[model samples]
Target chain A: MMDVADLVERARRGHPRAVARLISLVEDASPELREVMAALAPHTGRARVIGLTGSPGVGKSTTTAMLVRALRGQGRRVGVLAVDPSSPFTGGALLGDRVRMQDHATDDGVFIRSMASRGHLGGLAWATPQALRVLDAAGCEVILVETVGVGQAEVDIAGLADTTLVLVAPGMGDSIQAAKAGILEIADVFVVNKADREGAQSTVRDLRNMVALATRDWKPAIVPTVAARNEGADDLVQALDKHQAWLEESGELQRRRLARVRDEIEAIALTSLRVDLRDDGRLDTLADRVLAGSLDPYTAADELLA
Target chain B: MMDVADLVERARRGHPRAVARLISLVEDASPELREVMAALAPHTGRARVIGLTGSPGVGKSTTTAMLVRALRGQGRRVGVLAVDPSSPFTGGALLGDRVRMQDHATDDGVFIRSMASRGHLGGLAWATPQALRVLDAAGCEVILVETVGVGQAEVDIAGLADTTLVLVAPGMGDSIQAAKAGILEIADVFVVNKADREGAQSTVRDLRNMVALATRDWKPAIVPTVAARNEGADDLVQALDKHQAWLEESGELQRRRLARVRDEIEAIALTSLRVDLRDDGRLDTLADRVLAGSLDPYTAADELLA
Candidate 1:
């Protein structure tokens, strides 16, 4: 086994094997995780994180591939995290999608990983940010975190990125409506993928109205693209650049990064506490009393904490 | 304002206003929440919780109403918690759904409330179980928790129920495919809603195939229903009853309830701890160091906890 510090050092030099191993350590919550994180900490927070999210059929994977291609064209080292918060039951579904991403398989400049939450639902919440740190410290200039689904978990994961791109394909029935209102708030750029489709203009108009309704300093830009043919990739990249520029000028970038770190710290602490509560015999005893109606959950919680 | 004990006492008598008030307290996370929960504790553990989940536009609301009607015909008092875990951006969207539920407005035996998570993501996790406790103590024989979206949050909420009905409608693509596999494991029964639609039979066949793939002590039963016309509701009801019987006979009921209580306690304890971390100035200091790359999040989390 390689030493944690030595592994982090190799990762910092952009060794793909070292990067993959570090991410595995994060995923497994390995015993040396604390040392690994401390070793990598000083090198992180440099990569620009962009989150892409939409419903399943909205061409998120295609758009992601297009963006990765565009970023590589710009001579940038990129990392892609395709996070699936769905059941681990359909692991093959995501693997099939990853195979299509083989467009970058021969390109050493790009690193792509697909992650699915296994066992406990909290596992995703606990592991994703740590994985992001691995990519960031490994000297990736740009990291695209693309997550499946349009639910609250998607919104929560989108919050981890520096910029969030919300994708909506045409004829997907008010794709934004299916996306829920939270996605609108977090959207730094709206990509109307499959823009060659019939309802593309209408989807764009609807998103414009929704954006107009929200009050914020940086109005989210909507970029239309047919990601399958890589159409409008340049426009999407320009939109991303503009958003990053705005983030820096408005001083929101620092603020957002700080908030993200704050949340990551809090989630880690809470997860550790949750694991303790799970392992402790006292929780079972308290749950028994609550189940028996001799104690309320809140009182039981207080007792457990005490 | 009525005393907490008096409110709980009235709720036990199935007073509509009292029950509504108690639920409001849970939603607001009111100062008297702990007291209200303590007062209501002993009366809980009686209601049968049924969770209904499906993708958007799949007739979950309609199926839920139909089941409520059938259960009412059986002379049982019911409570419905329509939980929307979407962004509070479209409050009116769920309100519109709730207005349709006004069909049972005149019936004193029914209590329906629509809860949209406001502010934080953790808000829903902390509030839903307590709200269940409120309905459980208010003499509701069966409480139906109908949640919007087909994400992990829905799965988590479904875990709180005694029996979970996964709804799938025809012509909705592979409706169950869109629903993550975690949903399948949690489902006690599957309702092929919109059975009158063209593809209903095929949908049922697909579900049976999926169910056959998973080996469990109890294979989930798939029932077809046209909930809009209130067709096949009796079969749905029968399926639920049989599942409940199995739950009780196989000792799964006790185990499920115990696990639910254990989760409830853990969530409560973690939520309290989160509130503390949010308010304390130390977290901000830790976040700053993390942002500066002077410390990693895991180490910073340890410091915050210390």
Candidate 2:
């Protein structure tokens, strides 16, 4: 078996198997995996992480696939991290979204991985960003992070991404009503996917009106696309590029990257604490007591700390 | 100006102001409010909490309101707790759903309050069940918990309720596709809301098929309804009653309630630990060090525990 450090080294050298192995290690949260992540941290931070989120059935997976192909066609290496909800019964993901992008499965320029949400509360699994870092250090220029879009987790994905695309479909009732709060605010660019639908124009109109209501500073452009058919993908890519340009030219890119770094640090801190609590015998004892009626949970927790 | 103990006493005696104030204090996670929850704990475990969840636009709020009215009509005092997502910009909620059920606002038999998600990852906000306890202790016979119908939070809400109703609307794409994993297993009863829509029959068919596929000894029932018209509500209520009867007949009600109480205690303990970490000046230092890269977050967290 390849040791985690060796796997990390190979991943940093762009070995696909090594990259997959490293991600598995992180997701498993094995104590041994920490050394590898620590070693890889120095090599990370080169790739731009973009989060793609939308309500389910909005073709986020298809859009992600199109973006990967588009970027790969432009001679840029791309990585896609698709986060699927964990199956409560099997403790595995039912849909491996990476399989949907099988067209590029053999393409060396693109690397696609599907991650289970693993019952983690905040959108991506705990190891997701860490896996993205591995992909980043493995020579990917653009990493797309796709979340199983459920409100706050979607927002959390946006927070992680340098650029966020909030996807929406037409005819989803009152388009504004379907759009959760803060989703409209986070989009660097909004893509009305499945634009061939009847209500496509109305969806765009609704989006424009809502965006106009929200943003006072820089206006985000809405792009229409049929991602499944690959229609308007080039235009979508151009829009993304324009948004990136604005971020760079306006110096928001640096600020966003700084925020990402700050968030990453906080995430790591919380993960560490969680791991410690998981490993400590005291937590188990507290859990048992709390599960039993003998102790009030809050007081028991305080006692554990004390 | 009311003390927590006095507030608990007043709330237990059915004072609306005291109940509302107690919920606010608990939801705020204020240091001083812990005493309020503790004081109210002993008087809880009386109300039957039912969670209502579904995709957006399924009229979950409307269904919840109807249920509240139905329960009140039976001469059972009811409480409605609507969980809205916290505004990402303001870190507060608009609490607009209260207006949707305004008819019951002035009814002494019904008490309705909206609680913000407060950045809590899951639907069962850490403070939510505690707030429910307050209502339970305040003499509510049935408590309705409504969430912003997404996926995981929906599941969390389901798990927290004595009985969970997964609402679905007609013609909303593939019913099976919409029935995500966590939801299928958690929903005790499937409600096909908006029965007036075109695909209601097919949705019911899909739900029945899905339930048949499940291995559980007790299969959940599919009930169709147009909540806005109050059509089929009596049947829905009858289905709920049948399920409750089953629980009672099998002695599962007591078992489930016990398990829930245990889970609540454990959750409370974990939350209290988080609060302690935040309050004891440990988290600040840990955060600073992790941000500065002076300490690895994992190690810093370990040290704090040590």
Give the interface-residue alpha carbon RMSD of model 2: 6.1
Complex DockQ, candidate 1: 0.54
In model 2, which runs have C-alpha deviations exceeding 4 angstroms?
A87-99, A120-125, A153-155, A177-181, A195-218, A228-231, A245-255, A258-297, B86-97, B119-124, B153-155, B170-173, B177-181, B194-202, B229-231, B245-306
lDDT of 2 by residue, A1-306 (tens): 557777778888888888887777666666665577567655666788888877667888888888887898899999988766453321222264656888898988788887764545333435666677678879999999887653454336766788888888897634346343566668888899999999999889887887778744567779999998989889988988888888789888767765555445445555555545555567656545433434455675466546
- For each candidate, the DockQ is 0.54, 0.24
Cα deviation at B168, candidate 1, in Å, is 1.5
Residues B1-306 of candidate 1 have per-residue lDDT tens digits of 658888889988989999899888887778799999888888889999998877667788888899899999999999999887664333435666787899999899999998855664357777888898998888889999987654554337556888988787888644466443665677889888888889988888888888888777889999998899999999988999999999999999999999988888988898888899899899999999998999988889899989
For model 2, how many clashes? 0
lDDT of 2 at A160: 75
Instruction: Tell me which residue pairs clash in candidate 1.
Output: none
Model 2: docking quality category: acceptable
